[model samples]
Target: MDVLLTVVVPVYAVEGYLYQCLESIRAGLTAEENAQVEVIAVDDASPDSCGLMLDGYATRHGDLRVVHLTSNVGLGLARNAGLVEARGKYVWFVDSDDWLPSGSIRAVLDKLRETEPDVLLIDHLRVHENGRLQTDASSPMLRGTVTLDRLLAVQHTAWNRIMRRDFLTKHDLRFPAGWYEDVPFSNPVLLAAERVEVLDRVCYHYRVGRFGAITATRSERHFEAFEQWDRLYAWLDATGVDQALRIRLFTLMISHLLVVAGNDSRVHPRRRRQFFRRIAGLYRRHRPEGYQPPVGTPGIKHRLVAINSYAMYSALRTGYRVAGLRRRSTERTPVVSQDLPSAPQRVQTTSLR
Candidate 1:
């Protein structure tokens, strides 16, 4: 029988949590749901024992398949590999460190069967280090069909959603292998989607570990985020996505850059200033002729900082330099807590896919 859904999991150095993630998959899908489920776990040459564990799981589970990568390609490439190999009508990408709630697949499939939407957004819980679960207020975005403009105005994480494989393939939608890759890929998908459904039920549990992820490292790779944003803006202008939608998209992009720049204490003052200036210039250059700032109760500090542009950048630089100096003088390590429960091991099974 044809598969109903293909869940693509990109594994990389997540050996500690891989078993738990796979077990969540097995336990989450009911027998009927399991019959329609096909899991494609792509191991991106994880330096840890994750590849071995994945291989073991494939050997035991009939529904699980493992793809071993020779080199460490980024998450975008790993996800793309899974996408190309997927045979399900619907595709869902889950990070190896994250897991879906029980019956999540069946819930998504039920929505897909009823709405037949190009994309389905589902709510997710952000699991913190204290083992506390926070209901993301942004969860409502998964409730029903929404326009591209509306979706862009809120959160924009690519995970926690189910998408039709045909829709993605037809539009050539693939994640860009760079920092903040979602910005470029997801915007276009949103614009191209004919229909989108938002499921109110929480399906994904996002584990926010205390240990920083790739995004925490500030390096040349982080600069790639700017390139991704530029490409997205160019695409919007060239394709002429609804003018209103374009405005919202532009505002959101600028807002995101401002927040990042303001929060980054590692950026040099000169570089930070340059970054803000560039963003402000882009805003002034591309904003449509009658563009007016939205009036709200109060603008966020980052948004306010973005308004000054250069000044904000300079301030960030100064703060970063002081923080760096302080760190050098103190020779002290900050205390951090790691209190989340350990992921459970999985029962190995043979491949059924």
Candidate 2:
């Protein structure tokens, strides 16, 4: 039987969550549907027994294919390894720390058969450590007829979308190495696709606060987002996107950078001003001709960046933080929080965006 979908899972130090992640893909699939799906799990030189576990699991499951790498290649290149082995009509990259919701695969397959889209976007829930699930703010935007600009407004996570094999190959949209790799890859995939469709359903359960998860950890390497966005700009120039698209992408780039800057988990408090200054520099460099900032808080942020006023930006962030604290205090509700690294300002940082 011809493969309809290939689910690529890149495994690293996720031994605790690997079984659930693998099982979720096959959970709601029927026998016939199972035959049409292929799963490639890449063991990226994990120090744990994940490679051995994958080998054992592949022996028991005919649909599972395991790729053992000689050395750790990080998340992006590990995914590339799995992609090289993908043979299905469409490829979906599933993170080893996340799992699909029940019947998600079936729903995806149905949509794939119906629309035959070059790219398919799906909604996902943020599964907190406390087991609470929250819908992404961008979920509502996924509905209706989605254009490239609208799709770009949504999150750029690779796991939320499936790409037709030929579309990816034709564009040569391989993941780049290093953090924030999705920044370049996901946006370009949406831009390059001729036919894109939205599933409009919560198909993925993205686990937050997972131990050893990149986003949940604090590190200086978060600066990699800058380099990644630089690559995206290079792609935009190479593709010769229209001015309208450029304006939209520029807005997204600043918003994403602000998120990185504000997230205390990602950026050190002492270096946040430095990061904001860098964001301002990018804003000045990439601001399209005749570009007008959007209205409201985001507009104000864009203006601040344009002027390179890190002090004003910091004040704005502080104002919002104060308002949030007042609002939460009025409610007087106990918070279920993740275990963050011990720092003086650690308690203040929790999903600013």
Candidate 3:
């Protein structure tokens, strides 16, 4: 029997969340659907019990297959390994710490059967640390058959969609093995896609873990983000894709980098200026014609701030220092207010020992 979907999970030292994520994947699939679904868990040389847990899962479930690596590789490499090992017709990438909502797999499969699109985009729930929930509803984007350019402009995350295996293989699209890998791969995938379907259903629950997660913590590895952005922009310039699409990709890259710089404290002042200069150069070189910036507060400022390297670096350094001082002052002061909301319920989902 041919498999319909393969769920590829790249596990690192997320031993505490592995079982729950697997269970959520199982629960998301119906009995029949589960039978057709192959769960490929790639252990990226985790120091914790994640590798052992994956071994146990493979032993118990007939559909589960665990691939253990000897050394720790980044997320993109693990995902690429899973892609190579996948035998299903369609592939869905799921983070080891995150899981799909109930019946999400079946819903996505149904949509896939109906549309038979090269790529299917679904909604996702952003689970914040403050117990706030945000949904990436696809209705607005689902008005018509979306072109590659439009899809590139809208969705950036690879986890929220199910992509046909042949399409991926044909174009040789693999995630770049780096810290910010998705940006480069996603642009190419979108450019290669002929027809993409946007399903409004929310299928993914993205857990926000502040301290331990990759996006939250400050690290020097973030400097590589600029390199990936440069590669993506270069790829767009070389490809035969529409000029409008190329411009959109460039703007999106610059805007995203600015936001990352704004939020990060570890990025050095000189490096921030360098990133800004690179983006400014791209903006001038491309000079996207009749390009209207997206509406909203951050949208306009993000573009404007990205245009000037010195201004951005200065503002970023000042903001970082101010935030650091504020945090220190708050720590020194006693708790004076009781009106603040309580922290969200934190669930420890697994046990390594």
| Reference-based lDDT, residue 21, model 1 | 88
Q: Name the runs in model 2 displaced over 4 angstroms.
A: 334-353
What TM-scores do the predictions have? 0.81, 0.92, 0.81
Residue 13 deviation, candidate 1, in Å? 1.3
lDDT of each: 0.72, 0.86, 0.73
Ranking by lDDT: 2, 3, 1
Question: Per-residue CA lDDT of candidate 3, range 166-204, in tens?
Answer: 999988788887888887887677677777677666677
Top-down TM-score ranking = 2, 1, 3
Runs off by more than 4 Å, candidate 3: 136-150, 265-275, 281-309, 312-353
1 or 2, greater by TM-score? 2
Residue 62's lDDT within candidate 2 is 68
Each candidate structure's count of clashing pairs: 12, 0, 0
Write one digit per residue (lDDT tens) for candidate 1, span 243-271: 77767776677777765665554344346
Provide the lowest-lDDT 10-residue window in model 3: 344-353
Model 3: which residue pairs collide?
A: none
